[model samples]
Target: MEQNNMQDLLKRYLEGNCTPEERAQVELWYELLDSKKAAANEAELEEDLAEVRTRLAMPFRKKGKLFRYPAVAAAAAVLLIISIGSYFYFNNKPSGVPQKANKLLATDIAPGRNIAILQLGDGTEIALDDQSNGAIAKSGSNTIYKNAKGQLTYVATESKEDETDNPVSNSLRTPRGGQFQLTLPDGSQVWLNAASQLTYKISKTSRERLVELKGEAYFEVAKDANRPFKVLSKGQVVEVLGTHFNVSSYDDDPSVKTTLAEGAVRIVETGGHRNVVLEPGQQATLDSSNRLSVAQVDVSDAIAWKNGKLNFNQSDIYAVARQLSRWYNVDVVFKGRAANVRLSGEVYRNTNASKVLEILAFYNLNCKIETNNGVKRIVIE
Candidate 1:
């Protein structure tokens, strides 16, 4: 639609006369707005919106007034309308509706934290969460410690490596609503996301560095000319001399994704029959059928958990829901037909899950959080 018509539609939406389909589409555009750093509090935003309703009707609803001012300006009615209109015009979406947003509860479900368990070669498990920073344990020839800086590191001396002719193996695993960073004996750093695990084995007798992964992890591998770093996840293996990359191998996901951030990586299917090389900003996905496809991607989406953000940019409802389920430790159920909507914008990792649900529900009109049998869930219609 034309920008002028887009502006008129915004006026009608605020007047509460939009059709259901129009309303849903407009709200989807609202979700696309970048409010991650909005200076206004929730209450203030709502109050200003009420005033905006009156002001929108009185003036500036005239034809072609859209985009008369700078965007990302405060949620002033004219500016927001213009911004939304511009988005609609450029993206080829029809004009949509508006509704008073409902307030989100400060629900008990909190965000994920730095928590994980370390299992030694001797079969001993150490709870790393709530443990004070200090020397944590000794595994084979490796002395494991959690430094004051909160990095879990292992120190292996040459003599100790010699003492252990047999390889020493250990695993670091994170549960739902948990995350962690581990520095391997060879100095490669791995950041494990929620519901993920990384297992590594090292030996002086071995020539290569290898680690097995389940779920997702970001790696900053330490370089050694003699030893190439290799990551083995379901269906695929990634080999790099020394580089930064992220691997997501969730069992529930249809594909295992390996994203290269800083260096080159060679990815091979488990059978070693198919292979692909990736450059920075590229990704290789191994599907359930063992077919591999390469493409360029936004690397931030792959490592957003490590960087402390939840991204919804150009994402479907199910994709956004899966991230929330992992970080909030909740199950999502569809009450009727799933919303089948897409979302955009990035939320602070620190924000409560309820706040997100509120925004999502505001646009979709049929999503909310509830507790049944003491288990938290997001019910979608």
Candidate 2:
């Protein structure tokens, strides 16, 4: 395919307008590019990589895909075939690296996996990480099951006459370095991020489906006009009949961001009685003073974590540190000018802390891993 044609297809794919065949063709081209790069010599590899970076630096409009960097989109261009493997290979190498002094401290601090704790209404806690797949517990008219993929699902059965009036509430929590997904009694699905909690009541009597959340979560609400789905996070409440959206309300973060992927939502700030409505691809931010602001955004970037990727678009070092702290369950200490550094890229969530820090080093941000009484700390200078 020609360069312009390939770029057009990629734009269409990012905009969710590509047909199945076109999507497959682009994917196959990407695979071939990676394979070819793997077999290329160092000189040829570097040249192709430079072209990839140049293509990535091309500016795109807001209405198109929100790429953290042009290099991300450039990788899909058939005119310039570059392997992404070179980046990983170069960034992961530790030979003659200055940060090698603290290499030993980087051990054991790995990426997070599927893990959570399920608390029944009776105050009984089940360690979801240790539990095997299958039915785990029963809450009133709901049957809680853990699937082979570690997702917790709720199946509603015929409600007993005695349980109709009494609704039992259950809570699911993901500690630092953990994450989990669950299907609510009403069929609404939610993916909870690290150090987050979600509480919802399961009953057939209630006309509204409501959930309380802390930290961050991506919701795919089931449509039921009669019973509106509502989410309460921090001091804000988001009400929607049925839609796909994400909410970020981490206590340590200064702002709460609600991004909608499809349909519509109404955000109500309980602290100030303020409300705002959001459309698809729009984000509403609530600051400390309960002030609300809305802006156009790339919904895919907002839900990147749920898709197993960390995306940074002109984000500062502190923002990157926050993500690392949650995923690796480690503390980040900025010693010098590290916090001012800005980064833009996409990385798999499963990448090790050391590898990620190494990539930061490429951008002139020095980092080292330190251990104090067995607790790992990432110190940037």
Backbone clashes under 3 angstroms, per model:
0, 2
Find the candidate with the highest lDDT and give its number: 2
Kindly list the per-residue Cα lDDT of model 2 for residues 256-320, writing each as its tens digit: 99999999999999876789999999999999988899999878778989998776666788788
Give residue 279's lDDT in candidate 1 (0 to 100): 96
lDDT, residue 180, model 2:
95
RMSD to the hidden true structure, all candidates: 9.6, 8.6
The number of the candidate with the highest TM-score is 2
lDDT of 1 by residue, 252-287 (tens): 888899999998999999887899999999999999
Candidate 1 TM-score, true structure as reference: 0.74
lDDT of 2: 0.75
The window of 10 residues in a row where model 2 has the poorest summed lDDT is 79-88
What TM-scores do the predictions have? 0.74, 0.78
**91 Cα displacement, candidate 2 (Å):** 11
